[model samples]
Target chain A: MNARLYSVVFTFVLTTIFVLCLAGINALASGTIEKNEQLEFQRSLVYVFNIAEDIDSISDEKILSLYGNRIEEITGDQTVYVVNKDGSKELAFAVQSPGLWGTITALVAFNEGGTKITGIDFVSHSETPGLGGRIDEVLFKEQFRGERISSDPSARVAVVSGQDTDSKEDARVDAITGATRTSESVQILLNKAINSVLPVVREVVE
Target chain B: MAESKKTVFLANIWKNNPVIVQILGICSALAVTNNLTNTLIMGVGLIFVTAFSSLTISALRRMIPKNVRMMVQVLIIATYVIILDIVLKAYLPSISKALGPYVGLIITNCIIMGRAEAFAQSHGSVLSFLDGVSAGIGYSLVLLAVAFIRELLGFGTVFGVRVMPGGFTPWVIMIMAPSAFFILGAIIWIARTPIVKKK
Candidate 1:
């Protein structure tokens, strides 16, 4: 066989086989992968709503029950997940802002008055794993917990390099040691969310 | 002249290690060796890709024309890598997310291509599979060693556990790219001393 003809036939046959195999594998695994993704999203919702503690050990069944029992999903211009605690209602809303590498989506929960942040959880981000990615760490997320957002329009929760002294009204949280860019992005996102998303959510609640 | 299966299998781990001696797959050696967990996942993925790709290529060695041998080997390898990626996504989404680009980049890992061309194309299926497995092991060991030091000094932990004492301060350099070069260099120097003395 001529070199050209043999090359064409050989490559054509090999490509067909490999493609068919990949297609089969993708088809078989797509459903399970989608389910896992959905489950992970549910876990994030439960975490942000403070419905469950130690979510890492919580199974899919546990997350579903906790989420279903405590959180109610309201869809509109932005989806809000509501949590009722001690006869008062708290609302969790998703915040989308550009990060160092890609967009970071965090679910931020507010008290019934929308004055204090009850919880924060970064659902998705593309920051560098040990550096900027530490934004997802529990310590970092905990900084925003129980932080009050002042009535001033420009005020929001902030991540500082060192300790924040005004633990009561400062609304400042310590940032990751080596992740300045991600920290700054988070701060900006917090202010943006406080300014814009809060009012819309307030109207929804009222 | 066929070599013994034992020698063929052990060759890649020490005698002619793909990382230390032949130096085939260094790109990933530097990229994913910052953390122990990422290094382990990348190592296992490489081992799986190399072993199966080698086996498939060797089995079809006779039918593959000389003009398109490289093309066939790559196709087989790419198929295996895609399968690994999909499986990781389905079963272990967290690890899959951590690996990110390194998973897709396995298709271009020279170790798989080098083994397929040098050993799998000439040897029988069984021998080729052994060579592939050993090569991956060699690469994995080198990567894990580098990651151990990087993670320990850089993060004061191993696999995210705080192994370092309370007084220890983390080295910022260890977590960055430059640390990989220094660690990889020192590892090669230490690993190659005995290999060179034998000659």
Candidate 2:
């Protein structure tokens, strides 16, 4: 065989074998990966709804059960998860906004009257970890549990940096230090969600 | 013609340390060192990729045409990295999420390719594997040291456990990438000062 031809043949043959092996491995694990994602989304829904306690320690089975029993899925322009709390209906929906690197997807829940936020959980984000990504930390998300939404709609929830957020009803959360751009992005995202998405979803639920 | 296994392994760890000596794979070292847990996982992932890729490259060195050896080495390295990624996603979803794109970026780390070109191309499979693993260990040792300081001061924690008292205020700069630059530079200077003096 010609040396050049041999080089081409060897490279082609090696690539085929490796790709086939990767395909086989991916096929084997795709099911489990999908299940993990589904379970994670269910976990986020459960967390945002605040239906169960000790979310981090809560078992996967418990999350699934809580999601299955208490949540109602309404699919439309925006998918909403509704859970009835003490005879009043609370609604949660996934919202997307631009972040430092890419889109930030958050599951945000509203109180029965939509006047205050019940809870918030970050579903997915591409922010830089340890800085912008601190949004996923319990310390940050926990502040949204009972924050009131401003009626002006221009700024429903404020993510102010270096500010004291002592009260839940203040409708403000302190941004991660040294992450000014990401903090600003979060504020913009909240305003968009409040001004555009919330009223439309509220009408649909009603 | 083959180098002794101990010399090959130990040299990569200190004498020719990938991060400090060769200066390869500094990108991931800086990116993942803000936290201990993430840095550890990244280290393990690199070790697995490098070791397997080196072994495979060494075994196929004779068969791979000289003109296409680099391409063949990359293909092998990328395959191992993809396998590591798939396995992480299936078994350790949360850590997988934490590491994010860094896992996939392992293919471009340069340490594996450096091993393939400088050592694996001429070495036997076992020795090449040892070289790859030691290089990874050397890289990990430096990264973990940096992470220890960063996580301690930045988060007032070690491996996510709150070690400092409640009133301890964390150092905000330690949580960012520029801090890694300063720490890694200091580490390189301290590790190399003796070597430079002896020479």
Candidate 3:
């Protein structure tokens, strides 16, 4: 056999064997991975709503009993996962925005009047670990809870450095020290979430 | 024979460490070392991929044609990495999520490729597997050391538990990739001093 022909046959055989093995493993694990994703999403939803107990302890049956019907998919936008909190008074949705390194996807919950943040949770981010990534810290996220957005269109939530923002009603947050870019990105994402998604959600719920 | 196996295994852990000495897989070291928990998972995942892929490639080396051996080696390595990714996602979703694209990036890790090319291609399956495991362990040890310093200085925590007393200001630079470079350079310098002196 020619060396080149032998190499081709050998490569083909090796690739087929490798692919078959990976496909088998993937098939076996896919169901479990899907279930885990669904559970994680549900858990994040629960967290954004401030349902602090063990999400696993709350059964799927219970979730269905609580906010299962409240979950609705917008026709054109798949990025938004809206959870209606009865009428048009409160809602939560997932938003994605570019972070310092990559995309930061977060779940932001807002009051029915669209004038305040009820809660927030980072769904995913690719920010630098330990630095900008600290934006995902619970302490940082907790600051957004009950933060009132200024009703004036000219006003935007400001993420300022070295500011005293202990008051959640102030519509401002002290940026995580040294993570100004990530904090700024979060502020931009918050504004986009409020301006674009909230009105659509308000219409559907109201 | 037993002595040779031991030598091959021990060599990678110290004299030929994949991180400090060889500097093969430093990308994930910088990316995942911010937190101890994520670093631990990443280390374990790398160990599994390197060990199993080495075993598989070494087992098939005899029949693999020289002309296409590198291609075959990569295919085998990629398969094991994907398997690791899937398993982690299924069994350890939180860690998997934390790891994110880093797991897929394992396929591109030069350590795995270097081991396949240098050790596994010429060695018997069992010996190559040991070599791979040792190399992975070597990488993990250095990464954990780096992660320890980074997490402590950056977050004032170890494995997410606050250890520093109040008023201890965290060093912002310690959490960034540049810090990993400095820490890793210092580690490599310290680790290589004795090796260089012996020569």
Clashing residue pairs in candidate 3 (N, C-alpha, C atoms within 3 angstroms):
A89-A112, A90-A112
Q: Which residue ranges in model 1 land beyond 4 Å of their true spot? A: A150-155, A162-166, B151-176
lDDT of each: 0.88, 0.91, 0.82
* Prediction 3: B-chain TM-score: 0.96
Error in Å for residue B123 of model 1: 2.2
Clash-forming residue pairs, model 2: none
- The TM-scores of chain A alone, one per candidate, are 0.92, 0.95, 0.84
Question: Model 1 over residues B15-114: C-alpha lDDT tens digits?
Answer: 8999999887888898888899999999999999999999999999988988778878878998999999999999989999888888999999999999
Worst 10 residues of 3 chain A by lDDT: A78-87
Ranking by lDDT: 2, 1, 3
Candidate 1 vs 2: which has more DockQ: 2
List TM-score per model, in order: 0.91, 0.93, 0.86
Which residue pairs of candidate 1 clash?
A: none
Q: What DockQ number belongs to candidate 2?
A: 0.83
Best candidate, lDDT-wise?
2
> What lDDT score is found at residue A182 in candidate 2?
88
| Local distance difference test, candidate 1 | 0.88
The runs of at least 3 residues in candidate 2 whose Cα sits more than 4 Å from the true structure, single-residue gaps closed, are A161-170
For this target, which candidate reaches the highest DockQ against the unseen true structure?
A: 2
